[model samples]
Target: MRDIYSNVLVKQSLTPAVRTATATGTAVDRNAGGGAMFQNALVVVTTGVITDATHTITVEDSADGTSYATVAAEYLQGTAPAIVAADDSKTYELGYLGRKRYLRVVSTVAGATTGGAVAALVVLSDPRVTPVVRA
Candidate 1:
C-alpha cells in the first residue's frame, strides 16, 4: 500500500484557543492549501474540564475572515457533557465540497460556575492539488 500521509494535501491540528474565561476564540484561518477547501475536512473537538458547562462547536466560513457565516444546517455537531461527565469529545464533518475560501472552527462556551477547555483538529485534502503555505 502507498503512504497515506502523501494523500493528505492539507492538514492542521490546533488547540486554536482554550478558555479559562468566557472569551470566544479568535479566528483560525490556518490558510490550509491557500484556502482551497480541498475535497473534505474533519473537525474534532476534545474537552478537558467540561464541568457544568455548555459549549457549541460550529464551523464558519468567510472570504475576508472579517464577515463570516455558518456552513451546515447542523454545523454544531456536538455539545458539552450536559448530563454526565463522560463522552467529552466529538468529531464533525466539515464538508468543503461547495464551501467558501476561509474556514475556521468556532468554539462558543459558557459555564455557570467554571471549567471548560477544548483542542481542535482540522484536516483537508484534494488529490489533484498541492498544499500551499500562507504568508
Candidate 2:
C-alpha cells in the first residue's frame, strides 16, 4: 500500500480557467487516474468579484460519463451570504463512499450583471479499492 504522495500533486483542476461571468462550466472528467475508487475529495474554490454575486460550487459524480448527480451526503463549507468582494475563497471536503465510477465539478453564478471570476481545484484521495494499475 503506497500512502505517501510526493513530487506529484494529488489534485485536478475542474476548469482550465475561471468560470465565465454568469456562466456554468461543462463537466470535466476526473476518472482519468484509472483508479477503481477514491474516498475523499477537497474542493477549493477561489473567487474574485467587483460587486454582489451569488456563486455556488458543487461536486457531482456519475456511474457513466454522460449523466451526473450531486452526492447527497456531502456539502461544502462557505459563507451563506453572497460574496461581493474582490477576493473570496472556500474549500469543501466531500466523502464519496459510494460506488460511483466518475466525478466532476460545477459552478453557478447569479446576482451579477457583470459577474466575476471563479476557479475550482479538487484534491481527491484514491483509496485504491483494486490497488492495481490497468492499461
Candidate 3:
C-alpha cells in the first residue's frame, strides 16, 4: 500500500464578457499524466449587480480544458447565498465522485445590465492515503 498527500494543484479566474447566447469563459488545464487525485472540490464565484435583482450563474468542467461540459446547470437566483452584489463574495463547494484533471466556470448572464462579475475561482483536492506494510 501507499499514501499520497493532497495539495493545491491549481487556481484561476474566468470573466469572459457575454455577447451571444453563451460564451466560453476560461480553461483550466491539468496535464499531469495521473492528473490531480481528489475526492471533493470547491468553486467560488462572485458577482456584482447594478440593482438588487436576480441573476443566473452556472459552473462547468472539461477534460481538455477547451471543450467544456455543464457541471451545474441550475440558475443561481438572487435568493441563493453568495448571489449578492459585487461588494460581497460567494464561495461554493462541490463534491466529486472521482478525480478530475480540468475544471472551469461559465456565466449564463451577460452584460453590465445583469451585473455579471467574477472575482476568482478556487479548487480544492481531497487527500488520499493507502495502507503500508513493513517487515
Most TM-score-accurate candidate: 1
lDDT of 3 by residue, 4-87 (tens): 333444356455232223344555543322443444455666543324333344556666656666664342222223343444
Question: How does each model score on TM-score?
Answer: 0.64, 0.62, 0.53
Model 1 over residues 7-115: C-alpha lDDT tens digits? 4543443363445443333454534445544555556556665565565666666778788886655543343222213435444444444355556666555653554
Whole-structure CA lDDT of model 1: 0.51
Backbone clashes (count) for model 3: 1
TM-score, ranked from best to worst: 1, 2, 3
Rank candidates by lDDT, best first. 2, 1, 3
**Deviation from native of the Cα of residue 120 in model 2, angstroms:** 1.2
lDDT of each: 0.51, 0.52, 0.44
Q: Which segments of model 2 are wrong by more than 4 Å?
A: 1-3, 6-13, 16-31, 34-36, 74-95, 129-135
lDDT value for model 3: 0.44
The better candidate by TM-score, 1 or 2, is 1
The per-residue C-alpha lDDT of model 3 at residue 74 equals: 42
Question: What's the C-alpha lDDT at position 46 in model 2?
Answer: 58
- Candidate 2, which ten residues in sequence have the lowest lDDT sum? 3-12
State the lDDT of candidate 2 residue by residue for 30-119, as single tens digits: 443454345555555556543456665666767787787865653434322233544445334444455565556666666766655666
Q: What is the C-alpha RMSD of each candidate to the true structure, in Å?
A: 4.4, 4.4, 7.7
